[model samples]
Target: MPAQALATLNPETEEQDRRASVINELEEDESVDEVEHSTQRGAPNTGTTPANAAAQPDIGILPSGQTQPSAPDTPVAANVDLNDVVTAPESELLAMQLDTLPMPRPAQPLALLGSEVLPGTSARLAWSPGIQIPGLSQPTPVLAVNGIHAGPTLCLTGAVHGDELNGIEIVRRTIYDLNAEELSGRVIGVPIVNLPGFQQGSRYLPDRRDLNRHFPGSPDGSLADRIAHSLFENVIRHCDMLVDIHTGSLKRTNLPQLRADMNNPDVATFTQGFDRMAVVHSSGSPGMLRSAAVAAGIVAVTLEAGESHRIQEHQIEAGVNSLTSLMEKQGMTSRMFVWGDPEPVYYDSDWIRAQHGGILFSEVDLGAHVSEGEILGYVADPITNAQYPIRANSNGRVIGMAVDQVVMAGFAAYHIGTEAEIPAE
Candidate 1:
């Protein structure tokens, strides 16, 4: 019988059994034991099932006789103190809906990156710092489209690493495709933030410092810091929500997914706006733009598409479609977007590393599901003509991985995504 039809036979008992069954499956699986000892934050922790996760609460599956907190009453942008909520027991996160903003964002002009964009219009602005890099006379580009009606300001920033070409294209296609008159909220797109690195075709700033690590920057700090400060204050501060687009760094590639801090009710809810995209639970590292934005009360999430430096059309198309669906969900667009089945939200992830340095080749493609102990790839020594098979430690899906190339010992190779029970308080 269909589960839904069976669910009606004994609703209460069925629900309790369902929750218990999920926990039992996780605890009973031998692979789950291996996952508990593995590294954190690679793809997602492997093992367990989310068979009924879509029907469960966003925070987590609930136990019998327990009720979640009611959704917040105010709009997400009212600057609510989320510290208490985020710190609350995991159960409360299931019901908090912080993105419930009042409709029609109060039709107003948006002044961003030094340009005044009126309602129902679009403009191209420039973002330049007070202390510019040598020979960087040209300012960075910022695209804005102010909707005819009022709504939230949704910001899309790309190319923060300079060589992440896929992000630049994603931002361009998303913004240009939107019609200003049909939009509800303002859409701000910055196609390139690290122009210096872009010009040099490198991932770091001219000083070799990573621009991504200096978020919510200081004007009196290093070159990267100053530029981060300008962008954050001038461009980012005006946003009600932010999606900092990115691709895999170095030679790694990611299945189209979102890295989000699920503890934050606002961020958790905001992630639901995307359609058919996997959600990987991550608090985000310090100094990351997504982390900094969340700290500033903005609902934010990082969208990871493909590998860096290359513009893959399939990745670009997936990103654009997801963004379009998000805008539709957020009421920024009048268009209809039919959403697909909810993608699994991996609560835990870990990266499996190579044991030996050699020319590596993957057996499983990105997004492939692998059983525990399955061979993921082989690391073959070019000089000795010997090969070593790299295997998965737990059952999971490949969410991120290194491209076929020479690898070093301890190189992160495959990222595994798994669903697991959030421990009881």
Candidate 2:
């Protein structure tokens, strides 16, 4: 064979082939989610599932034997110090949500976490002076920030889904040739929150925990929760602001946008500043890192960049520019951060899903404008090739689109950001 033909035949020689394999691995991992989903659907007691049904309270476990002690034995306290209640034992605090949070022991080589860590200032709480996750050959991620000048604590975390590496790219690039002295506060970038999942290219950790859902996590929950708790407690607790970075995982693409809870009185103000924002209205899901920040009263927002687990230059550029703009917005940096092309299309949006299981064929690109009744996409039977048109029920901009041509019944095929529009010239 000719030299050109031989080169083409060599899988190890092509960088694109490696990337393609990585993408395939991500896709396969998502397939595992489908299996678990199928298990839930097929379970005989699906009604008992908390996901499928409203959770019932354990009324039976209430204090049944307790006598009526409404008033304390010593009914004297008119002016007792409230500090008694304010500064309770960690044991008591831990018991309140005993079953939920991380229960991690201090690393055996507790010294593994550096001995004297400089917890950053209030504004840059997430930027710990220095620490380490022991056992890992890598000099833990904490030390990555050492010697960096104090600045606003801007946390740009990515790949919480493991496969979504777009945000990682943003964080990696922002730090390249960065000058701490030039920054006013701090930038705490956990480019990959779910390191194990990222390594496996899976969404959840090995223990099946969704790190995103476990918020304000306990120091004693699952591994993911523990890590999250450690992260929040040791990192974000001090920051005045946080920006979580993410990409559309599971074969979907989201237009570069901000997903924040417009309903949050504290958070709504900043995330909404951008021109193209997709307000998720999610203050905090139980395990989500962002929600934990929200509860902690930190100004936090999650930015959706692009497709999952891959480095798209435009996406990275968009993310970097957005982060810089956000930093400047908060008066952290002097860098000129440009707003995205097209004034941000603001919206309170929801998903339009497939009603019947079929293959999803999209008619529009993410970020494309659409009218009511427009053919946003079509769901077709794979074997029969019979098409079921998925139309837009309301006028909106497409914030997300399914990357997979195949989808199932009730699968979210498209997400429309309503009340958004291209800026007028």
Candidate 3:
């Protein structure tokens, strides 16, 4: 039976059936010691059945698309001191509705990152890493849009690696299109997380550190560590969910897709919510924002789109649509937005590297499906005009590829995702 249909069944009957199944399993078991231990632990004797457990009252939707019962009018977490989080004026809180979704509550003030952002208001807060130059100090911008009604706090962060421009624009547009009065929960956006690297148009910090490799930061550690610690403690720790956006580095472009730890059922639902993008199951590297946030018990996912340093309109638009769809799925907005056709979900992916050094060109675009032994592109020696065809080693879709440019032997040129058949070496 469909999980959605099962969710609507009588809860009492379901529990009774579950108990009966446990009893049958216990009766059939021949191990006396195991049975005695199970009896003492009050454990179910049968292997657990996969069932759609009753959804939490606070969470709005199930993975099966069924709506959960509305929660009672409970106050926000008392532990979250709202005094530091600012609140907007009543007039501003009631300003305008950007969508048709019903508001869950009147706007209320919330505080974050040492600033108070009122309900129905959008504000840009700043964070400085305490690194002062001769006459200049750079402060990273943290954008917040608090909704009139109450809902889970969703944080959208971008440009962790300064040159990843697609995410910066994605976060900006996603927050810009929202109307505070119409929104149900809060949306926090950090468009440029690596200010110094972004200013330099580089992928690493001025100190030559990859800012992304340090998380849950240390106050007494290096510059990167301090910045990470500050953001994690002051901003990320407050979010109920997070979407860390990125782009391919080093002249590579990625198809608009999701790289997430789908092993987590909640994370899997979040990935599936972005209907039109491909999903690559990944736990992510240590110190990554996605990994750290998940470890802190926040549901998080990463969205990779296009190449670094330049904004691709198609990729940006796709990201915005996917995020908006996700908000709608979470009941954070009443907007009626439908995602296009679904994309493939791959459990594994590999990169095809160049065997010879030369100027390069691609025959296929990002997101194109290719067959085993198919010609993907060619590497040409500029002076000699010698062309070498690049072929796919296995059947798969092109999730990422290097832009047309000079290349070196062993340079990763194409990233292919496949469900079966290992690529030929």
C-alpha-based local distance difference test score of model 2: 0.64
Minimal lDDT window, size 10, model 2: 52-61
**Residue 222 of model 1, lDDT score:** 96
lDDT of 2 by residue, 1-425 (tens): 23443344345446356445545644665566664454332336544544321121111112354333332433555887766756467777787788787542221111113343232221112222222345532322542332224444556677777888888888877755355445555555666767677878888876887778776666666676666776777666756788788888678888887777666656766764554345554445655777778777788888888887677888777777666667677766666655654354464577898987877777888789999999987887878878888899888888887885667888888888776432221
The full ranking of all candidates by TM-score, starting with the best, is 1, 3, 2
Off by over 4 Å in 2: 1-140, 143-151, 272-281, 337-345, 420-425
Residue pairs that clash (backbone atoms under 3 angstroms), model 3 = 85-110, 85-111, 86-111, 86-116, 87-109, 87-118, 88-118, 101-334, 217-229
Residue 100 lDDT in model 3? 50
TM-score for every candidate vs. truth?
Answer: 0.74, 0.64, 0.73
| Candidate 1 similarity to native, TM-score | 0.74
Query: If both were scored by lDDT, which would come out higher, candidate 2 or candidate 3?
Result: 3
Worst 10 residues of 3 by lDDT: 49-58
